[model samples]
Target: MSDTARTIGVVGAGSIGATVCADLVLHGFRVVLVDRDPAALERARRVVAEAVRFGPMLRPGLPRVGAAEALAGVTTYTALEALGGCEFVVENVSEEWETKRAVYRELDRVLPAGVGIGVNTSSIGIGRLAAETGRPELVVGIHFMNPAYLKEAVEVMRGAETSEACMAYVMGLLADLGKEGIVVGDFPGFVSNRISHLFFNEAARLVEEEGVEPAVIDQIFKRCFGHRMGPLETADLIGLDTVLLTLDSLHESYRDDRFKASAHLRALVADGRLGRKTGAGFHAYGLPAGGTGAAQG
Candidate 1:
C-alpha cells in the first residue's frame, strides 16, 4: 500500500496505544484511535498533542512534522466499527484473556479479510491470541515498548501458525515507523517480559518479605549493576496493576510458583496504588486523575 493510503487502527487509547498513535501520525500515517472510555479518549488526544509538541525536544533525530498536521491525521472513536476502514490493526487492550479474546473476536469480524492484527501483549501467548482470532497466521505479536514513539525496537513474536509473509509485512511496517523488529519465537512473556518480570517479581518480594526499601533496591541495580532503571521503578512506570496481571499470566502459562504475584504488589493494587499512572505504586507520582493513573488496565 502507498504511504498516503495506509490507515492503521489502534485499539485502546491508554499510554501504549496513545503513544503508538502519536508515532504513526508523526510519521504521516492516518490513524484511527479507539477506546470505550470517553476520559481515556480525551487523555489520548492530549497525549498526542503533547507528543507532537514536545517529543522532538526529547528525541533529537525525529522528523520535523507540524503538530497540527500530525493531529489532523488522527481520528478518535468510541466504537470498534470505526476501524473497518483501516488496512492494519494494532490491539493494545488489557492483558486479561477474556478482554483480549473479545477484542480479537470483534477485530476479526470488523476488519476486512486479509488485514493483519498485531497483538501487543506483554505475557499472553501469541499462539493463544491467534487462536482466539480464528486467523492464527494473521495474528502476530508486536510488543512495542511503553512510549512507543521513542522506542526504536519492538519485540515481534511469530505464533505457531504465523506465516512468513505475515512476519515480513509486519517487519516492513515497523521499518516504516523507524523501528527494528527483533523477531523471536512465540512464548509466554516472550523474551523481554519473561526476563524483566522475573526481576520485577523478585524486587517486590524483597520489599515485602525482607523489608528492603524500594529506593535502595533500585539504587543497587542502577549504581552497582549499571542498569538504567530499577525493577520497582520500572514496575511503577509499567503500572503495578499491569505488572500483577503479567505476573498472573506468566504463572498460569508456566504453572510455576516463582512467577506468582507478590503480596505487596497485590496490596498496592487493591488500595488503588498502580504505579506512575495511578500517581502511586512503589512510589508516588503526585496523584493524577482517574484511578491508577492513565493506564488502561
Candidate 2:
C-alpha cells in the first residue's frame, strides 16, 4: 500500500493506541485516534505532543512539532463514523468480548469495505471477533507489546476467513512500521501470551503455594533467565486486572488447568492491590526497595 493510503484509525486512545498513533505519524501516515472518553483523547494528544517534541524515534536534530501543531494532523473523534475513510482500524479496548463486538459492529457499519480492521487483544479468539465484524476477510489480529512504539515484535494473526490480500497488506504495513510480524493462528493466547503466561503463572504459583516472596521469585527469574523484569513486577506494570483477565481468557479457551488465574491474583484484586496504578501489588511502593507490607492498593 502507498504511504498516502495508510490513513489509520485507532478505536482506543489508551497507552498502546497512542503509542501506535505517534509511531504512525513519525512514519508519514495520517492517523485518527478515537475514544469515547474525552480524558483518553486528551491523553492521546499529550502523548503525541511529547513524542513529536522529542522526535519520537526520529533523528535527534530533526525539527519536531509543538503540542498544538503535533495534534493538528491527528484528529480525535468520539463517533465511529469518523473512521469511514481509514485504510486500517485498530481496536484497543478492554478484554471483554461484548465490548469488542460492539466496536467491531459499529466500525463494520461505518467503515469502508476496503478498510482493514485489527484488534490488539492479547488472548481473545481472532476468528470469533472476525465473525462478529461481518467482514472476516478484512479483519486481522495485530498485537503490539505494551509499549507499542518501542517494541519491534508484533504478533499478527489471521482468521479462517482472512483473505490473502489482507494478510499481505498487514505484513507489509508492519514492516513499514519497523515491526516483526510473527504470524500465528486464531487460537486463544496466541504464541507470545501462551508461552509467556507459563512464566507468569509459575511465578504466581510460587507465591501462593510455596510461600516464596514475590520479590524473591522475581529476583530468581531475573538473575537466572536474564529477564529484565520479574513476572510479578511485569504484572504490576501491566495492571493486575489485565493480567488476571488474560489468564482467565486463556483458561477458558484451552480448558487447561495450567492456564487458570492464580488464587493469589484474585486475592490481590479483591484487596485492590492492582499494582502501580493502585500504589501496591507484590511490592510496596515509595518504600525501601522490595518492602512488601502492602502500601495502599
Candidate 3:
C-alpha cells in the first residue's frame, strides 16, 4: 500500500486505540476512530492533542497540531459504516471473546473485500477470531502495548489460515508506523504479555504470600531489576480491570498454573480500587489541589 493512500480505521478509542490512532495520524495516515461513548472520544482527542504538541521530537516532521484541530486528520464515528473506505481496520475493543467476536462480525459486514483487519487483543486466540471473521486471510492480530506511542514492539499473530501475503503487509504496515512487529504463534499471552505477566503475577503473590508490603515490593523490584516502573505501577497505568481480564482470559484459555489470577488483584478489582483510573490501588494519587484520601478500598 502506498503511504499516500493509507487510511486506517480504529474501533474503540480507549487508551491503547487512541494512542495507536494518534501515532498513525502523525505518520500522515488518515484515520477514523470509532467509539460508542462520546466522553471516551473526547478524552482520546485530548490525548492526541498533547502528543501532537510534542511532535517531530517523537517522529520527525509529524504534525504538531494545536488543541483545537489536533484530531483533524482523524474522524470520529459511532457507526461501522464510516470505516468502509479504510485500507486497514484495527479493533481495540474489550478483552472479552464475545465482545471481540461481535465487533469482528460487524466489521466483516462493513469492510471491503481484501482490506486488512487487525485485532489488538492480548490473550484471545487469533485462529478462533479469524474463523469467526469468515475472511480468515484478512484477519490478524496486531497486539500493541499500552502507551502505544512509546512502545516500539507490536506482536503480530497469524492464524493457521492467515496468508503469507497478509503477514507481509502487516509487518510492512508496522514498519511504516515505526514499530517492530514480531511474528508469533496463535497462543494465549503472546510474547510481551507472557513475559510481563510473570512480573505482575509474581509481584501479587509476593505481596500476598510473603507478607510483603505493596510499596516495599514495588521498591525492591524497581531497584533490584533496574526497571523504571515496578509491576504495580505498570498495572496502575494499564487499568486494573484490564489486568484482571487479561489474567482471567489467559488462565481460562491455557489452564496453566502460572497464569492463575492473583487473589489480591482480583479483590482489588472487585472492590473498585481500579488503580490510577480510580485515583488509588496500591498507592494514592491526588488531583492538583485537593484529592481524597486512599480511595475507599
> Which segments of model 3 are wrong by more than 4 Å?
1-5, 54-69, 286-297
Q: Summarize candidate 1's per-residue lDDT along 100-180 as a digit string, tens digits.
A: 989888888888889899999999888887887767899899998877877789999999899998999999999998899
Candidate 1, clashing residue pairs? Answer: 277-293, 278-292, 278-293
Ranking by TM-score: 1, 3, 2
Best by TM-score: 1
lDDT of 2 by residue, 221-272 (tens): 7899898788888787666777788898898888999988889988998899
Superior candidate under lDDT, 1 versus 3: 1
Against the reference, the lDDT scores of all candidates come to 0.85, 0.77, 0.78
How well does candidate 1 score on lDDT at residue 181?
98
Q: Which ten residues in a row have the lowest lDDT in candidate 1?
A: 288-297
Candidate 3 residue lDDT tens string, 133-252: 768988888998766766677989988888888899999988887888988988888887877887888888887888788888788778998887888878776777888899888889
Q: What is the lDDT of residue 296 in candidate 1?
A: 24
In model 3, which range of ten residues has the least summed lDDT? 288-297
> Could you arrange the candidates by lDDT from highest to lowest?
1, 3, 2
lDDT: worst 10-residue window of model 2: 288-297
Which of the predicted structures, 1 or 2, would earn the higher TM-score when compared with the native? 1
